[model samples]
Target: MKKYAFAASAATIALAVSGQAFAQESDAFSTALADGAVTELAPVTVTTPLRRPTTVLQSTSTVTVITEDDIEKSAAPDLPSLLKRYPGVNITTNGGQGATSSIVLRGASASQTLVLIDGMRVASATSGTAYISNIPLSSIARVEIVEGAHSAEWGADAIGGVVNIITKDGSTCENGASVCTTVETGVTYPWGGYGTVSTRGVSNSGVNFNIGLSLLGTEGYDFTTADNSVHEDGRDGFLQGAFNFALSKDFLWGRLYTSGLYVRSNPHFDSAPYADWMTGETVYGANEADQTNAAFKVGAEVDHSDTWSSVFELYSAFDYQKNFRDGHPEADTHYDTNRYGLSASTTKEIQAGAALNTFTLGAEAYRETVDSSVEYTETARDVAAVYGQYGLELDALTFNAGLRYDYDEQFGDAVTYNVGLGYELVEGLTARASFSTGFNAPTFNDLYWAYDGSYVGNPDLEAETSKNWEVGLNWAPTDTAAIDLVYYENRIDDMIAYVSDPVTYIGTMENIDKAKVSGVRATYSQMLFDDRLGLDFGFEYRLPKDETDDVYIANQNRLKLTAEASYAATEKLNLNAGIEYVGSRWTNADNIEYTNYAQYQLGAYTLVNLSAIYAIDETANVKFAVENLFDEEYQTAYGYKAPGTTVTLAYRRTF
Candidate 1:
């Protein structure tokens, strides 16, 4: 009972330090939505006859692709809300939309699971995690998710794998000249409303472009039930405005492109926890932040020949925040970061009797500068990296190898690599295996941050690394059916853990923990009734443990199962439903208080969702959806109540 009470009080503390960052690859995550009449139903991310319809990222055989169609028909309001419905993913939110959230992929925390928006990495240097909730689907084109590590190509941050976000662009136009507009509006059960206007076109001059504007606001419910010394009664609220644009043109020998995404949001949260802790006085009311995220990129892709190509780009990105308490500026705080980078890569393919060979070489350099209310010893850092890759394909076997070296001004030298192979075992079955190494660097807060009595920094912290191996099988009995089964293990060494003295109340970071994760993932997709009905299923079981503490990782479930069904009720009406089941998880990894009792467990929970889209015409449609169809009362985090049953209605049109 004591432990439960303490756990609840801890919820408020997370809101402040819980801000996170995400590392992304040069890739995508096949996202979630109602239009996936057949998601992950292909030999790769899609079935044959389908080459992802959209803008960037190289397609991989094991990735999952959620195309533009899926984004268009999605009923969920935010990305994280819908992400939980996919395989190898688990999500926990502080409350509703626009609130702080957490994502764990294949036992790797959010910081470990790389996040990329158009092949660009995004995250706050101090928080070490990405804020993805404010990115609306209205401005997106496609999302691809890869479940393992790609640090060899994406740097230390891609330790867990990658989730790529591709925004809307005119590059996919059928002809050299075309234009289209999409208007969408919707209302939610929490009494929120949203509207979006997006346009894309290619002109006669060969200038391709995409532009969009969106607004969303809601009277959200109190995001937490935790009780500190204060009381919060009013409903929390959320408001956001977003803008996106992309322009590109192809020349006889090359192509030039530029894209940008900017979003600003003010989300109300219960800051009573922090108020009482800070002022030692009773405070009541909703707290909020003027938060912003921005990214811009300009690049050129040169096609030297049919079998040779190269890409070079310059990019800049940042995350900003200013917190306000009880609508008063007296309690405000700020954190802002800026990053600029340059990258270039070239690929060459050649034919060698009976085998096709491909090679790639790339290099990149980036700098991060920070401005915060708290002064630190170091306010800037630089990273330079170079990498190479090779691939070979034969009649029955395929292989790939990659190597990368990085030099960080603060952390010094590090190297990473990956190797994988696949071979056909029978007419319809194939064996696959891979071995890889990856790492994650300590965040700015981990190494620098002026001493403030309670906590201090550790300039000696080292980078964390991982050794992983996996074996799997892919079987396609027929064009209409596909199956994948894999089992893997990962050992994370030099984990940066914070240790503190109980009596002195002083905390410091140290690389003293080692972690291990082993799991099995299996997925099956099949087409039924002549493709009118499609079904996809995924199952994963994992054991994420802390080798040093001799215990399992906290807040992570050991088993997860998911299923999705899409049915074309008629030529004009489509129906889709999804179900997710997550096994119980431990609430804490250790008993810091030594209460002589084991940790409590959050009970298992399941969610079911239903949605239907009725086409009014070729260019317009109406959508109705019900989330938490069963209203299962469950909490992904202790002391926090997840949203209950909610309904939504939306209308969309394209021309």
Candidate 2:
């Protein structure tokens, strides 16, 4: 019955698309389809905010868009490196490429940020976090970051914000039947070699498709050193591969699309006792770890009437990981997770007393399952949510309000809401304010896993909840310059943490903490010298504290500053440079006892990077980059040492 219902729904959407094609034609839709050739600086449409397509300038929330040109100019090796340049964003890595990386946005925990690929959630259900390190930049076309609570639109894990990645599509090519291919290869010391190949094309009938593949291998250095010794651990290594595909077609009604992404990586690290805080123990064994992440989605859109439009999609995602020590079968561990989802949304435009109003309604349903070697109290859960949003625009004043209700099999019910207001103070200045509520459900591992006596889960844990508010000002004084300033505060209750029982010293997940995070972020950018030179600056000051203990939050930097400058020396030559500063952080010492934790601080550091791209012609280019330009030694974590100065050289050819 369920299969039949799904098939019926898909058929209905296809028929709607066909019907709309015969009804009427819209120039707006045609312009949108042709926007693929537009410049990056132009206003772009995004759908993550309200589950309805809207221009960035029309959004009431603070947002940032990173385009393909920005990614190419940055010359970053991974997603973390590229994201570090943005304000209100922070990244920490255990080692080099393919290592475990964490992203903290606006003082929010790594798991609090919702990540999406092509409008489909792709994080691990057990861990409640996404392995963005495995995603290849070669396959990405753009990224949209909305900074604030977003549970009103997304059900869970949206306390910090949403990161939506859009991959390349064939529509990016010129009109008529066209095909394009790109190949790039590069090398950095210690890291042996990396290469990528991607192809995309568009048919005369408006059918578009794209495919990309990438591979990377590296002989990495030790990630950590001995507790009280100068000697470093053994060398770690990894090999990773990623693949992506996208297809789309434009009909009279709207556009229909399907996409998929797959990533596989194998990384080796030092084994337990050797890497652990123990004296006189030489590193002998290496642990092998394998990970795979995959996602697939199919969707369709259509215009029912001049004032009404709708979108429908079905998606599935899979995440798997396995670890082995010294190739011993007895010392093997594995975890696998899968998610299947269906969603639909509609937008309606109306006129009311000289004001224009837009209304959006959406519903989503998904089932998630986890399979692991270790026993779990519960292996699967179902979740369903319905949401609605309304926006009113009158002269220079804009107002938006939204609400969502979610029901989960494991955790009864949750309701969240958001309200926002925007006022145009002047021709070039705008003031905005927003208030929102967020919630995060406990992960499967946190609620049901039973690994050992030392580590256990608690099924009685409550959902973490938060209240957030922010105010901001945006000023574009001139065509070439713009500035943004924002201040935000977030208060979280029933925060989840790992706590140990005093009697047995067994660790389990608990809601025994609270946090208050407040911060100010500012960004400024300007283009000078006939648009030949560009300068951008960002500053952030965060005060993230644990209210339960009146102590600073662990692993969060209090202050951050970033600056970048780019110059088009000529039409064929371009130069770019950037600097980033991360403030001090507090964390427990490596050897601290679980019962009696001790805090330690790590000092701040700054890094510089430079890159240059010389175009051989319209179809080819060469790039040179230097990371950690000054070779300053630094550590984001207590024992982990960051990479030193490294150079990368690459050539890109397009046909």
Candidate 3:
């Protein structure tokens, strides 16, 4: 890492004395820095993963950070909306901001992605997933996304990746003050407009306070291509608040933190005609859904010593949804979940020759309680695990190994492990490889979601476990140019899915025996013209094999490509643009054949986004952005159309 500083400093001096011209240059350097330049340092450290600072590149797993500067430049409305800019992430949204947002990584479902707020799990055990839309983007300091399985080190709900949201802390204020405040307001157009206001301040007593409220209304587009049909379109608002306090700094110090969210939305899903199947009658009906979500999290972290730490966290979340279809009574669905856990770990670093060897050991236990009325399933279970990690540096090579054993009342026992090896092949080149295993317990809904006389519930179901292998190479041709290539393969045993009896229309969760997913990614970035301009390009490809003798899934894309560029044309001016292309794929769930289908292909679409900002003095600036420049009509969800032609104009002032 010291070598990186030396290289960056030398390049900075050259760029400072030179001048260049380019439309835009893009890379991690541009998006990760506070002012689009690594030379101008910020008070916050650059490598914090979740809540603590550490070397990012040397981590056992891949970590990608989206700084506050990146979010402000891109002008994304929420966290889920911003993740699409990263490599190897697939996002699906029902509509604009605060909507149903889902993420798929390495061919795994949205539920496989574990979301964390300052290292504590935010996923709902009842539905077995996180309602990402409920998470406000206002007070977030940074986001650290660690990609890939981490059951060995992170415990459950980590099969795909971990999205850790690190909120703003008291130290972010000026002069290390005990009190500070910040407020921002913005608007957008669609149905009605939108407005938001949020504030954060700290007390000299090591306490922090934050509150946010937003109101937005939209007169959504038509459900179909009809002249006078306004099926269902409405507006919604959200309120979120959080508080954190730190006690003394002695042996028995204490800390408390809490956050709550509330939202109300009316979304249209499908079209229906009014009629009675058993009786002849003329009726008028509409398709509409009203949904609400309320969630809260509380946690405390205690540091017992220089080498020991312990944390206890608890969370509760609830969701209610009702739908009206074709002149019938509203169908209601309710989901509630409770989660609690405690973790304790110790880290020891000892001098070994000329280097340091680190060892870590920890134990954790958590419980999930889920209840769903329509699902007709009630389940409760607790899970406990113990893990250890060893890291050592020998000559030019670094090695990391971890192991964990977990026992669950509902899923029996499982073992997870990981091993990583890295070697500095040359002065500017490095090679690395890692092997790990992960597991995901079946969700209650997947086991038992029933309707009418049909039901699906397999009491005896095995957890899905995956074995993954990855090898990668990183190269730096010069001080300002870096490139990387990685290949990964994942295989799963006893994957669970819904199986149905054709005659009875009854479905049951069953093990699929085997499934395989493999992929590769290539990324390149460079600072051109002596570091005044930047450019970044990357591509990812994935292929999933069912491996089940009786089933097949279609509509899976084999490739995704992303390109971004940023330019600091002048000391006071900055501009950026990004383009993404997602390949076409199929969408069939079962091997059984059906006639007269359009193959359900989502056409390949290209999206272009632009941003420009000019600094006014030192405390104020004007900004502008245009999203979906071409107004491309695309659908990430099966039948839902994405937003189009959004323009934003705003101003910012820093005190």
The candidate maximizing lDDT is 2
Model 1 lDDT-worst window of ten: 13-22
Full-model lDDT for every candidate:
0.72, 0.75, 0.60
TM-score against truth, every candidate = 0.88, 0.89, 0.83
Which is the better candidate, 1 or 3, if ranked by lDDT? 1
Candidate 3 residue spans exceeding 4 A from truth? 1-53, 174-179, 206-217, 222-329, 448-452, 549-555, 590-595
Runs off by more than 4 Å, candidate 2: 1-41, 174-177, 228-232, 274-286, 589-599
- Supply the TM-score for candidate 2: 0.89
Candidates in order: C-alpha RMSD to true structure? 8.9, 9.0, 6.0
TM-score for candidate 1, please give it: 0.88
Error of 2 at 431 (Å): 0.2
TM-score-superior candidate, 2 or 3: 2
Residue pairs in steric clash, candidate 2? Answer: none
Which ranges of candidate 1 are over 4 A from the true structure? 1-62, 171-177, 226-231, 273-286, 591-599
